[model samples]
Target: MSAHVRTPGWFTVNVLNRAVAWTARRGISVWGSRVLAVRGRTSGQWRTTPVNVLTVDGQQYLVAPRGHVQWTRNMRAAGGGELRLGRRVEVFSATEVADDDKAPLLRAYLRRWKAEVGVFFHGVGPESSDEELRRIAPDHPVFRITVTN
Candidate 1:
């Protein structure tokens, strides 16, 4: 959690996120997108956002491409959340991955989402070296999640 959060652009925060959330809420997933609903750390109310779910080697992961943002902070405090794709809600627990273990997950994530989230990565891509990935790993928080119910 030593990494600084990268604030998103006006379009991302306003237009793009809203459109994606609207779609996901309607039961459509755009590029593995889902509506992530977790309790706010202080408010104790459910907060929703659109997120990309990356699966590697049969393991599911949530990578914070924009670094340590609000949802990541809430996830840390809540310990779990619900992934909503239309009416299907998958409740799950999350474990934050250490920086040392993030390289591979980040690589796979970039491979899948580079077109959409590459800008937030500061020029790193799926083709980047592991060393290069590790260099930026601390900035991106990753969570390994298990579906509980």
Candidate 2:
């Protein structure tokens, strides 16, 4: 049997989740998009979470803080969903970026979110993932959503 290390879930999650809440409240935005719409695999509930939208070469993506989080799961399950940027909502098909580009993407993500990443990383050093993100994520899977706007 393979053993999986569980993601950190103590005070760390509490704090980072608050940031997520903040983004959700203020309608946080990135790359001109303020929200990510991921559907529930089983229930088909359309869940929109305010996320740091990162774009690379014109491709839009959400670098999930926790890879194993439901958002990623749904992204994988659905492969395509909707994105709401202001009142414009459009459907997009998602594809997971392979590990080869993880480092580059991570660096781009850090650049777009250095302040929050600073708070998130704390003392993890520039070479490490923040505890919250590292908990369920460290090596992350990038959810690239194709957009035609």
Candidate 3:
């Protein structure tokens, strides 16, 4: 199977994500929503975007359904970033998980966020077999989050 890399559409970028990000900024967590802030790799300035932070087994994760995006690249170079909700911000370091270890996390993420991000998964949902998820794991980067301070 090929990798799934989806760009956000007009509705997602302008309407849905904006609404969610706005609400989240007001301290309202719309299903673990937050504005992720990471320094741009080249620009060296903070770039922000709304993302769903998935917590599984007492650990938090950031999954990139869009695949190898700006934030993902930035996180790779920066090694850490912040998750903001309203006036609250949590600084954290991130480690990208190897593709082989992403199935469970991917499954959990899809189980929680399928309604919003399933389209990016290309028909692979939470119910997908481990093998199925493993095949597509390379496309979606999963990062384990550890709070810094």
Candidate 4:
């Protein structure tokens, strides 16, 4: 794959995603980390992607439902970027959290997502419990983005 895809799919995020981000900004939904808009590493275009965020002991972390994809790719590409929390902006560093820590981080995710998160855990049969999915995919990567502080 070339550095930049340049396809429409690569250029934009759909409305549903925008809504999640908006709600997060408004504190209406715990779904997005407000919005982490990273500059495209190659294209230099700004790309805003929704990510579920958590403040662990005052340090910030974000984890995606998807194991590895565009949003994650964008995060990896930038290494980090500006994180918008309400009216405040802070620089952040992106680190892919180790697999062994996925459980605790995912626990934070489950708390925030509740019923809304099932679709992402597709591997778990609808009847399967969260515990089941946790057991099955305990090694999935959870990316953590923390403020440079």
Find the candidate with the highest lDDT and give its number.
1
Worst 10 residues of 3 by lDDT: 1-10
Q: Output the lDDT of residue 114, model 4.
A: 49
lDDT of 1 by residue, 1-149 (tens): 46678887899889999999999989999999999999999999999989999999999999999899999999999999999998999999999999999999999999898988899888999999999999999999999999999
TM-score, model 2 to reference: 0.67
Q: Per model, how many backbone clashes are there?
A: 0, 1, 0, 0
With a 3 Å backbone cut-off (N, CA, C), the pairs that clash in candidate 1 are: none
**Model 2 stretches astray by more than 4 angstroms:** 1-33, 118-138
Q: Regarding TM-score, does 2 or 3 come out ahead? A: 3
Residue 17 displacement in candidate 2 (angstroms): 7.3
TM for every model, in the order presented, reads 0.96, 0.67, 0.95, 0.68
Candidate 3 — which residues are off by over 4 angstroms?
1-4
- What CA RMSD would candidate 1 show? 0.9
Give the Cα error of residue 84 in candidate 3, in Å. 0.3
In the range 1-149, model 3's lDDT, one tens digit per residue, is 23455778898889988998899889999888999999999999999999999999899999998898888989999998999999999999999999999999999999998987888887999999999999889999989999998
lDDT of each: 0.94, 0.62, 0.91, 0.62
Give the worst 10-residue stretch by lDDT in candidate 4.
1-10
Candidate 3 colliding pairs: none
Residue 134 in candidate 1 has what lDDT? 92
Ranking by lDDT: 1, 3, 2, 4
Q: Which ten residues in a row have the lowest lDDT in candidate 2?
A: 1-10
